[model samples]
Target: MRLNYILSDLGIGLKRNLTMTIAVVVTIWVSLSLFGAALLAREQVDLMKGNWYDKIQISIFLCTKDSGGRGCTGTEVTTEQKNRIKQVIEANPDTAPEGVFGESKKEAFEQFKKLYKDSPIVSTVTEDQMQESFRVKLKDPQRYQNLVSAVSGLPGVDTVQDLRQFLDPLFEALNKLQWGAVAAAGLLLVAALMQISNTIRLAAYARRREIGIMRLVGASNFYIQLPFLLEAILAALIGAAFACGTVWLGWYLFVKRQAEATFQVWQWVGPTEVFQATGVMVAVGLVLATIPTFVTTRKYLKV
Candidate 1:
């Protein structure tokens, strides 16, 4: 009998503030979805770096006589200097590491032409204009700065450039985007919480006369508080469900399907991970809802 009354009261309270309840659910759904996307993006970025960073090499360009001050002065790299550089690299097993390169200038130029076949400007350039470069793979990519310092001052060395330097700005931009998403999600979550609290407070005020009568009749505090708490739980659970559905649908359509079609570099979170994250969000929302409802009822319903 008590359970039935609680359920009936919860149903009526929800019906009375249907619009507010819907608003709270939508807000929670948006917040959780944004948070999930941000987390997934960060994970993908880390995964890509781990998988691809080691394969990248530092290109050390040698000076050539015809090469203008675009860093490579036209002083052709001498055979002795080339051998000395190669010897130094070979001696340092820790830094030079292991990787194959174009065996001769002809092979290097051919490869370069092939790479830039679509560019008309590159097609017009001749072999003499091309500068020789030593492609050095590192044992540990993280120690690339050490290799750069060691090679930068050598006689024939024109420039020593790491691939990571070019990619750093891109990763920094992604980090900023992730933080922005998190901030937006936080604001939305606060809005959802306030909306839920206000809805419950109004429900309690509407039942003040009945609560006073119940107090006079010596009803227990637990019995008086149960219905309001249950109402809040129901609202939060609904919001969580909505959030989970939105995340799943968005991932399926946007990240999994659309991203693969447009940007092959994008790696999506799998369904299993998405479901697990959604379950956590549901649990968090339920807890946030319960705490506010419990506090409001304790102060207002003095049964």
Candidate 2:
């Protein structure tokens, strides 16, 4: 019976302020959607890092006839210079347990051919043009600077390249995008909260006379506040539901279907990540609705 009365009042409050309720719902939808996208973006970046970072190695390029390396001398690297670089890398504690693998000029040439086979310049390059280098795998890829700093000044060492350097900019950009989404979402959330507060205030004001009669009849504050709280929860819930749908659809269309298809070499976030984001959005939506309504009703409900 009490539940039915609360439900009835909830319906009345919702009908009485339909426009404001719709506004709150739309605000929650946009805010929660952005928030969920930000969460999914974070998960996507992590997935990419875990997939790519582990396999990346530091390549210490030796001087070639072209002299393209930063610290390289005019002449090609000698066998002794190569051996010395190998020894230094093997001796580093951060280097992976296995000995450093040296790629010969011929092997480098072959790889370059395979890589640039479709490019016009592949025919112009020769084996002698390739730089002999040591591929040093690290126990921790983040310790790349340790190896690079150690080898950068060594004789015949032209340039030390961490494959991570190629990836860092992309990851940083993605991180910035994630934070940007989060910032935008945060502002929208504030707007939603204010909208909810105003909705509750107006509902309370419209029902002030009834609230006074209820107060005179000895109705509790909780009973008086229940309908308004329910209204907020209902609007937020609808908004969260829509937000979850959009987030999932966005991931499925853009991330899973499009991105994963195009970038088969790298791992991407999938349904599991979307589900996690939706779960958070739903919780956030419920909280976003309840707190402001609770606060506003306590002050304005009159009962």
Candidate 3:
């Protein structure tokens, strides 16, 4: 009998403020969708970092006749100088085990030709013009600057280039994008909460006479508030369902279809990440609905 009354009252309240109920549902849906996207963005960034950071190589180029650097001379670097440079590269504590990879001028020229096979410059370049290099892999790519400085300006060394320099700007931009999404989602979440509070307060106001009568007849506060709580919970569940769907579609089209398909340099977020973000969205939506409804009912339903 109590459940029947509560359900009937819930239907009445929902019908009375149908407009506000829809608004609450739409607001929660948009906010939670943004929140879920922000989570996926964070996961994507972390995934890229893990996939690419280990493969970072610092290129140490030796002098050639055409080289121009502080350490470079007009003549080509000698074999002894090259051997000495290799020893220094291997001796570094940050150097990964068996990570010193030497590329001879012939090998470098071959790679250069393949890279620029379509360009006329490939014909002008010769093996003697190509500089020998050490492709040094480090245990910690973030400390590449230290290794670069240690090898810079050594005899026969022309230049040291860390791949992270090329990649830093890309990562920095992605971090900014992630934080921007989080900020936008946070503001929308607050708006959704405010809308929920307003809905609950308005419902309680409309039922002021009934609430007062219930209180006077020794009806418990739980009985009166149960219907309102259920209304909010039901709306929240609907909004969360829509938000989860939106998140899944976005991830499928953007990450799975486009990013993972086009880019092979890094791993992209998949269904696992989508599931995690959607779970959080549902949990947050329920809490947002319940807490505000409780507070509004307690405050407004008091005779």
Candidate 4:
């Protein structure tokens, strides 16, 4: 009987403020969806960091016949200079213990041809035109600058190029995008909470007389507040449902498909990530609904 009364009151309250209820649901849906997207973005950035950082190498280019740097003479670097450079790289503790490899002119030429196979100049370049180099993989990819400082201007060294210089900007951009989503989600969540508080206040105000009668009849405060609490929880759950659907569709249908077809450099977030995001969204919804309803009822539904 008490459950029946609470359910009836919940229905009446929802009907009375249907517009506000819908607004709250939509607000929560958008906020939680953005939050989920932010989580996915962070996962993507971390995935790329793990995959690419290990692969990134600092290339120390040696002098070739055509090399024009101050460190490069007009002759090909000698075997002695090359050996000296390798010794310097291997002796440095900053470099990966097993990651240094010497690329001969022939090997460098072959790699260049493979990389630029479609380019018209691939036929024009020859093994003698390619400069021999040492590819040094650092223990920490970010410490390439230290290795570069150690190797640059050495007898055979023409230039030191770290791949991280190219990759860091992309990662930084994605991080900024992730933080932007977080900020937007935070603002929307605040709006959702405020809307929830207003809806509860209005519902309590509309049923004030009944609440007063219940109070006079010695009904417990919990019984009176139960309807409002149920209403908030129901709305938040519906919103969370929407958020879950949005995240699942985005990950399974759009992001997964597009990334599988086009972006292969890093692993994409999978169903596990989606499930984690859904858990967060649902938890957020419940907490957002319960806290505001509890506080509002305790303060305004005194009768």
Candidate 5:
């Protein structure tokens, strides 16, 4: 009997402020969707880092004839110069002691052919055209600077390239994008909270006569406020469901179907990530609805 009364009051409140209720739902949906996308993007960036960072290496290319390597002087790197470069790498504890692998021109040519097998450049390029280099795998990939500083400007060292340098900027850009989404979501969430607060206040004002009777009949604050709280929670729940659905559809269409198809080497965020984001939306919705409902009823729903 009590549950039915609460449900009836909730329906009346929702019907009385239908426009405001719709506004709250739409606002929460957009905010939660943006928030979910941000979380998923963060997951994707971490996944890429886990898969790619371990494989990153510093390539120290040696001087070659016709190569514009620093101090190349139109001469091939000598055996003595090569040995000196190898000693520098071996001496650095930050670099993997035994992870130094040298690729000769012939080896570089073979790798080029395997990589660009279908490209016309393979037919035009020759073994001599490829620059020999030392592949220095790091004990800790973050210590790339130490290895590069040690080998740069060495007699045979033409250039020291850290593959991570090329990738860091891309990751940084993605992080900025994630934060931007979060900021937008925060603003929208605040708007939704205000809208909820106003809607509850108006509903309480409209039912002052019944609330006065309840107060005279010895009704507790909890009983008096239950209907308004239910109304807010129900609207938030519906909004959160819509947000979750939008996020899932986007991930399926853009990330799983499009991105994973093209970039098989890297792992993308999956359904598990979407589920986690949905959990966040649920928590946010509850907090946003509960706080405002409790505060508004306490302040404005008195008989």
Candidate 6:
């Protein structure tokens, strides 16, 4: 009997504020979807760092004489220096690193020219003009600084460059975007909570007469308040369900499908995470909805 009454009250409350209920559902859905996307992006960044960063290496270019009096400065790297660098790399297991070295000056030149094939300046350059470089792959890419510091002032070494420096800006931009999504979701969540509070308060006002009658009949405060609280919780649960659905659909359509097609190497968040996130959103909505309903009914039920 008590459950029936609670359900009845919940149905009537939802009917009375149907527009506001829809608004709450939509708001929560959009907010959680954006939040989920941001989380997935963060996850992808971490995945890339773990799986791809170690594979990237630092390249040390050897100096050679060129048009100007650049001793081993501007010209092609000599055969002796190439052999010496190879020997030093193979000998020093600590710093030489274990990546394939481009032994012939022609090989390094070909790679450089191929990389800049579209450039007009590169079209005029020949293999003899390019310097040989040691492509050093490290056991741990994070230790790139150690290798760079060690090789910078060494003989025949012109420049030491880490691949991470080139990718830093992209990761920084992604970080900023993640924070922006979080801030936007937070603001929308606050708005949804406020709307839920207002709707529950209005429902209480509309039922004041019935509540007065209950109090006059010697009904317990708990009996009078339970139905209203249940009503609010029911609404919250419905909203949370909608939010979860939105997140799942958005992830499937936008991140997983689109990103996989565009960037084969990138990883996306899976359904399990979406379900977990939805469960959290539902819990939050339930608490937010129930607290205000309980507080508002206290004075009304007492009368």
The best candidate by TM-score is 3
lDDT of 3 by residue, 171-284 (tens): 899999999999999999999899999999999998888999999888988888889999999999999999999999988887788975684767889888899999999999
RMSD vs true structure, all candidates: 2.8, 1.7, 1.5, 1.7, 1.8, 3.6
Clash pairs, model 5 backbone: none
lDDT of 2 by residue, 51-102 (tens): 8899888988899777866657688888888888888898888899994888
Worst 10-residue lDDT window, candidate 1? 94-103
List clashing residue pairs in candidate 3: none
Q: Model 6 clash pairs?
A: 63-72, 64-72, 64-73, 64-75, 65-72, 65-73, 65-75, 66-74, 66-75
Which stretches of candidate 2 lie above 4 Å from their native place? Answer: 68-71, 301-303
Show pairs that collide, candidate 2: none
Task: Spell out the clash pairs found in candidate 1.
Answer: 64-74, 64-75, 65-74, 65-75, 65-76, 66-74
Q: Which stretches of candidate 1 lie over 4 Å from their true place?
A: 68-73, 91-96, 99-103, 212-222, 259-267
Instruction: Give the alpha-carbon lDDT of every model.
Output: 0.75, 0.88, 0.90, 0.87, 0.89, 0.73
Superposed model 3: Cα runs more than 4 Å off: none
C-alpha root-mean-square deviation, candidate 1: 2.8
> At residue 31, what lDDT does model 2 achieve?
95
Per-candidate TM equals 0.87, 0.95, 0.95, 0.94, 0.93, 0.81
Tens digits of per-residue lDDT for model 4 on 1-303? Answer: 887888888888989999999999999999999988888888878988999998899888999888886678888888898888898899988889888998888999888988999999998877888888888888887677777887888876788888888898998998999999999999999999999999998898877888888988888888888999999999999999999999999898887898878958777788887898799889999999999888887764464
Give the TM-score comparing model 6 with the true structure, all chains together. 0.81
Ranked by TM-score, the better of candidates 2 and 3 is 3
Give lDDT: candidate 3, residue 97: 97
Candidate 6: 10-residue stretch with minimal lDDT = 66-75
Residue 60 CA displacement from its true place in model 3, Å:
0.5
Model 1 backbone overlap count: 6
TM-score: the better of candidates 3 and 5: 3
Q: For candidate 1, write residues 1-303 as lDDT tens digits.
A: 878888898888889888877877777777777766766666666766775686678887777775543444457878877787676665665564455242356666787888988888776778876767888788888777776776676777777779999777887888888788878878877887787788778888899888888888888888888888787777788777877788788788877887667855534567767777787788778876888887777766664
What TM-score would candidate 1 get against the native?
A: 0.87
Comparing 3 with 5 on lDDT, the higher-scoring candidate is 3
